[model samples]
Target chain A: MYWNADLECVPLEQRRELQLERLKSLVRRVYENVPHYQRVFREAGLRPDDILTLDDLAKLPFTTKDDLRRTYPFGLFATPLRNTVRVHASSGTTGKPTVVGYTRQDVDIWSEVMARTLTCAGVTQDDIIQIAYGYGLFTGGLGVHYGAEKLGATVIPVSVGNTKRQIMLMQDFGTTVLACTPSYALHLAEVLEESRVDRTRIRLRVGVFGAEPWTKQMGRELESKLNIVAIDIFGLSEIIGPGVASECLYNTGLHIFDDHFLPEVIDPVTGKQLPPGEEGELVITTLTKEAFPLIRYRTRDITKLYEEPCPCGRTHVRMSKILGRTDDMLIVRGVNVFPSQVESVLLEIGQTEPHYLLVVDRRGPLDQLEVWVEVSDKVFADEVRHLETLEKTIQRELESTLGIGVKVKLVEPKTIERSQGKAKRVVDKRDLYNRDK
Target chain B: MWVKQISVFLENKSGRLAAVTRLLADHGFNIRALSIADTSDFGILRLIVNDPAHANRVLKEAGFTVSETEVLAVEVPDRPGGLARVLDLLHQAGINIEYLYAFVSKAGENALVLMKVEDLQRAVDVLSAQGITIQGHDVVHQI
Candidate 1:
C-alpha cells in the first residue's frame, strides 16, 4: 500500500525534528557555499546558527525565479559542479531558463518522492506505465521515468508527440498508467477517439496529469472521456521535478512531501505568511536538495495548505491543486483575472471546448479583456440571435466570475493553437506602463 | 410542411463567403435563396440550397461551421402587399418570426418566403389555418 512506508508515513513530531535538522544543515551549506545566499544572509543580518527552529525559516530572505535567472547557470548551486551529477532546466518563454541541479543524493531523493507520488496515485510496481512528457531539458519526462523505474514498474518512455504512435504503443504495450500534462491528455483523447482503436484492448487504468494549472472540470472531462482516474501531480523545475506533491485516489487534496520540502503560504500582496486553509502564494524550502538548496523560494502558485490526518494515513501535509499563479494573474481595469477562473466558467457553461485564449489589449486608457472561445458543435446555433445570446451569456458569466466586464468572441473549433507542453492561454498586448519612465 | 435551412458561420472577411459558395458550387449545389446577416467581426450565411443535407455535409467537411434549422417556406402573393399580408397574419396569431427572407419563384411571379420561427409547428398551424400555402420540403428544388 505504500512505497518507503516509514518515511511516507512518518509521525508528525518525528518529521518536524528531521526537517529542522535538515534545515539547519541546508542553511549552513548555503551560507558557506553560495555567495548569493551569503550576501542575502548578510543583508538580512542573519547567521546560520540563528535558525534554531522551523519558525526561523521566515527570517531568511525569499528566493524567486528572477534570482535564479540572475544567477544564470550554476550560480546558486550550493555544491561545486564536480559534486553535481545531473541538471534540468525550465523553458523560460522570454529569458534564460531556470536551472536546477541534482547531486547523486538529490536525484535519489527526487526518485523517492516521485515514487511515493505514484504510489499515492495508486500505481503499483506491477503496473506498466507510459510516460509521454517531453524528455529533454524538461524535468517531467526523466523525473517520472526514474520514479516509475524506482518503483519497479515497466516503463515505456514514449516522450511527447506523435499522437498516432502514442496511442498505438498505449494499446500494444498494454500500458496501465499514463503520465503527461492535462492538456496533452485531452489531445490524446481527441486523437484516440478519431483513431477508433478498440478501447477494451488498452489496459489504461490511471493517468498522472500535471505541469500546468488545470481546473477540476478538466480533470472530470478527462476522467469520463478516457475512462481512467486522472490524478494531478504538481511540481516545478525550480523545486524538484514533478513530485513535490501528488493527489491521492481520494481526490481531496494533494499530499505534499512536507518532510523533505517545507511549504508555506504567503499573501502575494503582502508577502506575509497566511495560516493554513487560507489560499495564498506557495513558498517552498528544500530540506534535502544537495546541489541547489533554496531558502523560502516564492513559488507564486496560489493554493491552500492543510495539515491533517489523511484517510490514506500518509502523515504529509496536503495542498489543494494550484488555484492560479501570481505570474499568470492579469490586472484588467483594476480587477485581477486568472485564466483558470475563465476556464472554470467556460467549462461550467458546458457546451464550449475547454480551450480558450484571453487577449488583453488597451484601446485608450482602459484595458479591454477579450476572450476567444471555440464553439463546439453542440453549442453552435443556426440563428444570429442564438449565437449572440450565447456570447452574451458567456460575457455575463465571465463578468460575474472576474468582477469585470469582458468581451467574448466565439471562434470556430480547432482554431486556437494546441500546445504540446504547457498550454499558452493568454496574449497580453498592452504596453508596459513603466516603459515611458 | 417544413424546409431545411443551412446556416453557416463565417468570419467577416472578403473571399470567405466566396469560399463557401465555391465549395458548394464545386459539389454541384444550387443555392436557391441566401441572406447574409453580418456584424462587424463575423457573419452568418443563411442559405436555402436545393439539397440542404448535402450542402450542410459538404460545408462541414470543408471546415465551415454549419447548423441545420427547420424553417417554413410559404408561397406568397407576388404583389407588394403579398409578403406583408402573410406577415400580418403571423403577427396577429402571436407567432414571432425570428428571421425571414424571400426569393421569387422561377415558376411564377409569386415569391417563396422562408421564415425561421422558434415554434415550427405552431407557425405552420397558424399559417395553414389562415389559408396560407406552406410549401413542402421539396419546394426549394421545384420552385
Candidate 2:
C-alpha cells in the first residue's frame, strides 16, 4: 500500500529540510528562466537567495491565475520547448487557457506521484485501472494513465463519453480501479444501474476521483453507489496535474505529496497565512516542478490544511476536501449557498440521490433559492402524503441548515442533467436582471 | 382470504398512468381492478392484476417503485345496499377500512370489493363469522 515509503514516510524534520532545499532551488530556477517570476521578485525587492528556509515561502511573490493568463503560452516555462517533453492547458472557459510545460524529469515525477496516488487507494500491480478521465488537453486522464502504467497495473485507456460502452468495458475488462471526476463517477454508477449489465459482474473496487470540488457526502454516495472505496485526488494543470495530493484508504483528508507540493492556507482577502484547521483559500508552491515551477501559486480552492501525519503513515500534510472556490462561491440573498452544503443536507436526509441543482433567481427585490432534488427509489412513496412530508422535511432542513428559506422542488429521476466531467451545480437566472440593467 | 395488490409509484404527469397500463398490457397481465391515489406532484396506482408477483417484478425492473400489499376481497350481495352492507359489517366490528375499491366480475352475479383494513386478520374473522363470502385468489384470478 505504501508506494515509495521512504519518501512518503520521511520524518517531519527531514521532510521540512527537503522542502526548504527544493523551494530554494525552484525559486532560483524560476528567477533565472521565467521572466514573470523575475519581474515579480524584482517588484517585491527580493532575490532568489532570500528564500533560505521553507518559512520564507510566504515572503515569495504569489502567482495568480491572472499571472498565468498574463504569460499565456510558454512565457512561464523555465526550460525551453526542446527541453520540455509535455505541455498541458487548462480549460479556458473564463478567458485564455493557462498553459504548463513539463520536462522528462517532471513527467517522471508526475508518474511517481500519481503512482503514490494509486497506492494510496490500495491499487496495485494486480489491479486493472479504467481511466475514464478525458485524455488530450485534460491532464486527469493521462496523468492517471501514466501513473497506473507506472504502477504496473493493466491500464484500459477508456477516455470519457459513451457511458453505456464505458460500463460494458468496465464489466468486460474486469476493471479494479476507476479514475474520473466524482460527478462522472456518479453518472457512471447511474448508467450501470440503468444498464442491463449486473453490478456484481463488474470488478471495480476503488475510484480515484478529482478535477472538481466534491463533498464528503458525495464521496460516501459514490462509495455506496459503486461499491468502491472512493479516494479523492487533488491537482491542477498549473501545478503538475492529477498527482499533487490524494486520499488514502484512511480517507481522513488528502495527503499533499510533501516532497513535491508545499501547501498553505491563507485568508482570501488578507492573503495572510492561516493556521492549520482554519478554512481559507489554499495556496500551493511547487517544490520540484522543473519545467514550470510556481512560487506560492493561489489555487483559488478553499480548504484547511492538516500537518498531522495520517494513520496511513504518510508524512505528507493532509488537507480537507475543497469546500468551495474563493471566486465561484454562490451568493443568493446574501447567503453563501455552497452546493456541497446542500449536498450534505440531501444525503443526510436520506432517500434522495446525491444529485441536485440550485436555481437562484431575483423576482423583484428578493432572491429565490429553489433546490431541485432527484427523487430516487427510497425517496419515492406510493402515498402522496408520504412524498409531501418528505418535501416539507427537505425544505425545513435546508432552511435551518443554510439560514435561508429555500423552495424544494422534487424532480423525477434522470431529469437533472448529469455531467461526464464536473457537474453544473447552480443555474443563476438572476443574470437576467443584471443583463437588463 | 388475502389478495395481493401491487401499488406503483409514478410522478403526476400526463400519460404516466397510461404508460404504466401500457407496460402491463404489453406484458399480457390483465388488471382485475385499479384505483389512483393522486396529489398534485405524484400518484400511487393501486392495482389488482392477474399475476401480482410477475407484475411487481416487471414494474420494478422497468425502474418503477412497486410494492405489494395484502387486502381482503369480499363478495357483496347483489342488492341496492350491497357495498354499504359490507362497510356496515366492518364498522360494526370496530375495524377501520384503510381503502376500498370496486372490482366488477363477469363470471359472478354478486359484485366483488377489495378492502384494506387496519386489522386484516380480525376483519377476515368478522366477515367470515357473518357468513359473508371472502373471495380468494382462485376467484379473483378468474375475474
Candidate 3:
C-alpha cells in the first residue's frame, strides 16, 4: 500500500542524513530571507551555522503560533511573493488567520505527501474519492483533492454541505473513498441511515478522516455504520494542509513523513523535548518546505511518538492518536475538561447514545457545566425515576472522572446539532470574551 | 386502582413550565391534577390528565421528553387526619411511598391524593383490603 516505496521505506540512516541536510539548508535560507527568523536567531544568541548537527536544533528558537500571527501574511515567506505559487490560511475563529504560502515546489511536495496519504488508506486510481471537507479558504478539501488526483483516483470535488446530494453522488458515482473530517463522516453515516440509502449500493471501502481528533469508539461506530475502514489523516494548514501524516491500513498510529517534516514531542509546560513514548505537545520542523519553512513550530497538539517499526513497513516514526490540544482543554472551576473526556465517558456508559454537547456558563460566581446527552429511545421511555437515576449516575461518574460537579440534561435523540463538518462540542457563554471585560 | 400519569422533564428555566402548560392547553388537554418535583437544575412535572396517552404523545412530538407512569389515586377525607390515616395504613403494611400530592375534587369536599409507591400492586391490594376508597379512571375523570 506504499505510494512512494523508495521514499516511504528509505533506510533510517539515509532518512536522517536527508533530514539534516534539508534542515540545515532551511535554516540558512530563512536566516537570509525571513527577517523574523533572523531577529529570533540573533536574540537567542545563535546562528544558522550553529545548527551543524541535528542535536543543535535545540539551540534554535522555537516558533509559537503567536509568532506566526505576529508575522501575519508574508512575513515568514522564505521566497518572494512572485515565486509563491499559492497561499493558504488557517480557519482563524478568534483573531487574525495564520497565513501560509506555497511555492510551485511546495505544491508538488504537498501533492506527493497527499498521494502517499490516500495510498496508505488503500485508495487507488480506480477508486472515486468524495472529498467532503469544505473547500475555499479551508485547506482540507483542496489538500485531499490534490492527493487523490495525484494518486490517479477519480476525484469528486463534492465539498461539504448538501448531505443528501453527497449520498446520492456516493451511490451514483460508486465512491470508494471518503475524505472529510471524522465528525462529518459520522454525520454522513447518520444521514445515510435516515435517507434509507442502500449502503451496499455505494462501494465505499475506506474513509480518510481528520482535521479534528476523534475517539476510537467513534471509529468503531463509523466502521460498523458505514461498512468502511475509517483512517485518520493529520495535518495543519500552517504545515502543508492534510498530508503531514496518515494511519496506514494497519490502523496502529499515524506515520509522520519524517523525511519531509521532522517531528518531535516536548513537554508543553517546560518546552523541553521528551523521550519517545512520552505524551506531550507535538513540535514540527519543516525539513524541505520552500515557501513557508518553520523551525520547531509548536503544534500544541498533545500526543506521543513511537519509533518502533510498524508492521506496515513504513520506516517513518508514528504518532499516537492526538489526545487533545493544550488550547482546546477547557478549565471549569479549576477542573480541566477535554471534550474527548466527556465523549469517552458517554461511550463508556453505553446506555446513552454517543452524541452529546457540553454547555458551560457562569451562574453568579461559580462556573457551571451541563452535559446535554441523548439517551437511547428505550431508556428515555423508562420511568422518570430511572431517567433521574441515569442522570445521577452520569453526574456522579463525571464528577468522579472530571473532579468537578456537573449537571446532566437528558435530551431527546437528535436534539444536538449534527455537524456537516467538524462538530462544535462546547458552547461556553461565560461572557469573559476578554480578560478586561 | 392504577391511574396513568404523565411525567414531563422540564429544565429549570424561567418559562419552561409555562411552555409545557401552554402546549397542553393548545391541544385541549384538561389537566386533572399536577405536582412538580424539582431540583436545582431540573424539574419533573408529574401530571394527571383527561387523556394520558394523547397528552404524552403530543408532548413527546413537541420535543419534550415525556414518560408514562402508573400511580394510585386515593379519595382522602377533606379533614385533618384523613390523609394521615391512609399514611398509617400504608406504614403498617410497609408500603413505602415514593411521593404524593393532593388536590381538591370538583365537589370541593373530598381531597384526592395522587400517590406513587414502590410496589403499586401491593399498595393497591393492601389499601383495598382495608375498604379504603381507591378511585378508578372513570371516577377520577368525573371528579
Candidate 4:
C-alpha cells in the first residue's frame, strides 16, 4: 500500500543513515546560504561539523514561528531569489505571515511527496481529485494540485467556496477523491444533505482532509455522512506544505516521511527533547528542503511520535493527531482547556452533534468557560426535564474531565457558522474586556 | 378528563418567547391556555393548544424543544373564591396540585383552570364524585 516502497519501506537502520546524511547536508546548506542559521549557529557556538550524528541535533538552537516572523519575507531563503520558482506564505491572522520559497527541484520534491501522499490514501490515476484548498499564496491548493497531477489523476482546481456548485460538480464529474480541510469536508457534507443530492450518483471513495486539528468524532461523522474514507494529512507552510505526512487506510497514525523531514518532540517549557509517545511540541528539521531549509523549527503543534512499524507496512515513524496548538490552550480558572478535550468529551457522551464552540469570558475576576453544542431536533423535542438532565450530564462530564465547571448550552442546529476551511472553535471575550480596561 | 399540554424549554434570552409564539401562530395553531415558569437562566413555557399532536410536530420541526404532558382542565366560577372552593375539595380529598393556571371564558361567567397533579385518574375520580366539571379537550378548545 506504500507509494514509494523503496523509501517508505526502508529499514530503520538505513532510514537513520539516510536521515543523518541529509541532516549533515541540510545543516551545511543553511549555514552556508542563510544568514539566519549562520547567526543562530554562531550564537550557540556550534558548527555544521558538530552535527555528524542525528543525536548531535540537540546542539543546534530551535527555530520558532517568531524566528520566521522576524526573518519576514525572503530573509530565510537559502538560495537567491533567482533560483526560487514559487513562494507560499502561512496564514498569519495575528501578524505577518511566514514566507517559504521553493526552487524547481524543491517543487518537484513537493510533487513527489504529494504523489506519495495520494498513493498512501489509495488514490490512483483513475481517480478524479477535486482540490478544495485555496489557491494563490496558500500552499494547500497548488500543493495538492501538482501532487495529484503528478500521480496522473485528473485534477479539478476548484478551490474553496460555492458549496452547491461543488456538490453539482461532484455528481456530474464523478469525482473519486476529495482534498480539502476536514471542516470544509464536513461543510460540504452538510451542503450535500441540504441539496438532497443522491449520494449514489457521486463516486467519491477517499477524502484527504487536513489543515486544522479535528477529533475522531469528526472523522466518524465525516465518513458516515459523506460515505468516504476520511484520512488525515499533516503539513505546514514552514516545512513544505500539505505533503509532509499522511495517514493510511489502516487509521493507525500519520506516517511522517522521516527520510525527507526529521520529526522530534520537545517539552514546550523546557525546550528539552522528550521521548517518543510523550505529548510535546513538534519540532521538524527539513532534510530535503532547499530554498527554505529550517534547522529544528519548532512547529508549535502539540503531538507525539511513535516509532513502531505500521500495519500498512511503512517503516517511517508515525505521529499522533495534532491535539491542539500550544498557543490555542485556554487557562480557565487555573484549568487547562484544550478544545480537543472538549471534543473528546462530546464524542464520548454521544448526545449531541460534533460541532461546538467554546466561549471563554471573564466574570468579574474569575474566568468562565461556556460550551455551546448542537443537539439534534429529536433531542430538542424532548421534555424540558429531559433537556435539563442532558445539560447537567454534559456539564458534569466536562467538569470531571477538565477539572473546572463549565456551563453547557444546547443550541439550535446550524446556528454556529460553518467554515469552508479551519473550523473556529474558541471565542475568548476576555481579551476585549482587557482592552476596554 | 385529562388534556394534553405542550411545554417548551427556552433560554432566558430576549425575543425567544416572541419567536415561539410567532412560529406557532404561523402554523395556525391556536393556544387555549398558557403559563410560564421562569428562572434566572431559563424558562419553561407551558401551553394548551387546540391540536396538541399537530402543534408538537410543527413546533419540533421548527427546531423548538417541546414536550407534551397530561393536565386537567376544570371549569370554576369567574367570581372570587371560585378557585378556592375547588382547591378546598382537592385538599379534603388528599389530592395535591402541582401547578395550575386560569383563563377567563368570553362565552360565559366561567373560568377554565388547567391543573397538573401526580395522579390524573385519582384526581378525575375525586373531582367527578364531588360534582366538579372536568372540561374535556373539546370544551376547552371551544372556550
Who wins the lDDT comparison?
A: 1
- Point out where model 2 deviates above 4 Å: A329-437, B1-143
Assess the local accuracy of residue A267 in candidate 4 as a C-alpha lDDT between 0 and 100: 94
Tens-digit lDDT track for model 3 on A226-336?
899999989988789889999999977899999998999999998888999998899999988999999999987888899988898999999988876766556464234
Model 1 agreement with the true structure over A1-437: per-residue lDDT tens digits:
78878887888999999999999999999999999999999999999999999899889899987798789889999988999999997643222456899999999999999999999989998999999987877788999999999999999999987989999898888999999877678778878887879999878889998876566776887898789999989888889988999999887788889888899999989888899898889999999899998999898778899998788888888988877667876655423467778887887888788989999975642467999988766777877777888888989988776756799988876778999998889998854321110
The TM-score measured for candidate 1 stands at 0.60
Candidate structures ordered by TM-score, highest first: 3, 1, 4, 2
Name the better of 1 and 2 by lDDT: 1
Task: Report lDDT (CA) for all predictions.
Answer: 0.84, 0.83, 0.82, 0.82
Candidates in descending DockQ order: 1, 2, 3, 4
Clashing pairs for model 4 are none
In model 2, the Cα lDDT at residue B65 comes to: 72
TM-score of chain A of 4: 0.77
In the predicted model 3, the residue pairs found to clash are none
* Residue lDDT tens for model 4, A252-346: 88899988889999999999999988988999999998898888888888888999999889998888887656666564542336677788888
Instruction: Kindly report the docking quality category of candidate 1.
Output: acceptable
Name the candidate that leads on DockQ: 1
User: For residues B29-89, what per-residue lDDT tens digits would candidate 1 score against the true structure?
Assistant: 8888889898766688888888888888888888778899888888787778988888888
Off by over 4 Å in 1: A329-437, B1-143
Candidate 4 chain B has its poorest 10 consecutive residues by lDDT at B102-111
